[model samples]
Target: MAYSHDSVADIRSESFPDYEARIEDAYIEGYDPASLGAPHSSLHTRKLWFGLGLILAALFGIGLSVWGAAAHIWGTGTQIDLSNRLLVLGLIEVAVTLTLGFVLIASSRKGYKEYRKRTGRVN
Candidate 1:
């Protein structure tokens, strides 16, 4: 008797794949999860600070845009409509910052989970 096995699932099922998530998971799995507890969490503190800074900067830019709009800077000669674009650009900056913030938050969560899984640290 002979038996055969397929190495991979059929392509038609690709639509249901979790490829991107799996890739991200694989990358995260390569890290040392045992070092994620409190004292060691400091390793990620810098990232948190950086992320905070980004959010602050984005907020500052948006504030500036709002101020410009309130002041009607776009109505000024030669600068007309410029403030509108500036505001739009500021909004874009905020959006990007928000995205990065979410990513950082998720990474932190993954880190904590990994730490718990590897070192039995509960937090």
Candidate 2:
């Protein structure tokens, strides 16, 4: 008589087709449970602070970029040609900052949800 054996990796892959992708997503979003060592509540608080910091920084960057762009377009006394170049650069900066802000906000929300689920909190 012979017995069959299956490896853990094989079992996991068969059970969850997207297991690796899910793990990657969790890490990329900064909510990997494996990386959390503190108590659940403490981890939640730290995650909140980290997420808030990112959002605040992004907001500040966006505000500065918008101010710079506005100044380049109307406030600056430079020549039209130079001003146009600066204006374009400033606009690009504003767009980049906006995108980063959005990404940060989304990451924050996703991480918060993950934290709630892990802690079994409804609110």
Best by the TM-score measure: 1
Cα lDDT computed for each candidate against the true fold: 0.62, 0.54
| Worst 10 contiguous positions by lDDT, candidate 2 | 19-28
Q: Model 2, stretches more than 4 Å misplaced?
A: 1-80, 117-123
Q: What's model 2's overall lDDT?
A: 0.54
Each model's TM-score, in the order given?
0.50, 0.37
Per-residue lDDT tens digits for candidate 2, residues 28-60, read: 444445435533333445445665565565555
Model 1, residue 109: displacement in angstroms?
3.8
Residue by residue across 10-86, what tens digits does model 1's lDDT show? 78778676644322244343354444554436346666666667777778768866856764643656644566666
Top model number, lDDT: 1
**Which regions of candidate 1 are displaced past 4 Å?**
1-37, 40-43, 72-81, 117-122
